[model samples]
Target: MNEPRSTYPFIARGASAELFDMGGGQALKLFRDSVSDEMIAREADASAHAAACGVPTAAATGQRIWDGRRGIIYPRLEGATLMDWISRNPMRAGWALDRMGEIHAVMHRVDGGTLRSLKQVLATDIAYGPAPDALQRAAIAYLETLPGGDALTHGDFHLGNVMMTPHGMMVIDWSKAAAGHPAADAVRSEMLMRFGIGPSDWVTNLWRDWAARRLRRSHAAASGVSTRDIDAWRPVVALAWLRARDATGRTPAFMRYLDGALKQAGLPFTG
Candidate 1:
């Protein structure tokens, strides 16, 4: 496909790509050259598969080449992300978190359909993560005993990845889409909310902790997955996160939380 004209206004930039407002009610997600074609292709396929399975996401309308970088076109979605909305309407955080939980449950209802396995993804991450050899082995062995499922999982699901539009909430960024147990995905979401890079002030940290609990409760209720099941997946997920987490965000509180999860799951500490 032809590169978008210089006139296409810039919209936003993320870790891997820059978005442009492609005229005609569409947006262009032009990925960086450093991003592999295979990764981009997986995201494109996963996005289409998700939409076909009735997941609320912007399906790729087309693919294009902008200069040397690859890009995908999608129907432009208008509105603030769930994160931004929550920031602006802190009083409604409960409602928003509840809605997010419900939406996540609904997404998990669909079959992953040819997507990569979430367990394998987690195992790979843990194998390559910073955990001690014994800890990694213990976590991977433990991971094997956990239940697996074909349910669709938005591997990177969180408030920031969800958009609150006029129609409703639309999930974006399928780069990390995978098939796995709903409980495992829920654990991942909990970790992201509590420890992912962001403001770490005491107030924000308290809110984050509360928001994670609220989201987990909502998801458990909607999905019929127990908190115990989610907890069972937590240690491995937390271990794998060490591979990709921002060092700046690895504060003392996060380390304590990680240790608690590991201890609860009977896994070795990272140190």
Candidate 2:
């Protein structure tokens, strides 16, 4: 349990972890006390697995306990997150989204090997989520009928999780990696881009909707996964999301979207 030096430069903080510049081109991701050992282990293992399988990500180089908190060290990656880049270069959002879609397609080509099943994860979330028991039961039953796959799915893939590095786009944060159908993962990405926590002004939302559409088209083209396949998974995925989403993400618009998806999929509506 080596402690980080007091001189280590603090970098940034996220909901679950804090980052520090450890010099020598390394960075430490120190998890908060609330983060479980299982999650930390999963992220380390998943990141290494993704890198070994040719996914462009920074694998954990080492692990340490600092001040009783778990930390993983990774080679410092240089560049802004794809989300940040898009914010700064709004006019080039389409190009950036195209690249994001292509990269995601490439990632799905790899096998998830031994990672947790995506369907099971979703079922669990739906079971514990805010949906009515009837809806939860129906959603889980329908989810079982959907096709399954071993493709590597970045459970939380989004623009914010990808970096536009000098070397190219590199994905970060493997905490939610899973083995699942690519289309399901694609649907999750759509939800994130369209409804994840962010500014919700009418103009911003319109752009977000457009961006989500562009990304879906690009991913579908590159992956040979049809929009129908993605759409089929939307209702269940949206229901599962209710378990973990914050209040800001529970807007009336999102509820309507969820209702629409459920209706489209022939599942019981939230009403």
Residue pairs in candidate 2 whose N, alpha carbon or C atoms collide under 3 angstroms:
none
Judge candidate 1 against the unseen true structure and give its global Cα lDDT, from 0 to 1. Answer: 0.87
Q: What do the candidate models score in CA lDDT, each in turn?
A: 0.87, 0.89
Q: On a 0 to 100 scale, what is the lDDT of residue 50 in model 2? A: 89
Candidate 1 residue-wise lDDT, 1-271, digit = tens: 3345678898888888988997889999999878888778878888898888888888987889876678998999999999999889989999999989998999999999888899999999999988889888999999999888999998888998999999999989988889999988898899889878788877888889999999999999999999788788888887888888862554677778789899998888854
Highest-lDDT candidate: 2
What is the lDDT, from 0 to 100, of the residue 237 in candidate 1? 81
Write the residue-wise lDDT of candidate 2 on 46-82 in tens digits.
8899899898999998899877778999999989999
Best by TM-score: 2
| Worst ten in a row by lDDT for model 1 | 246-255
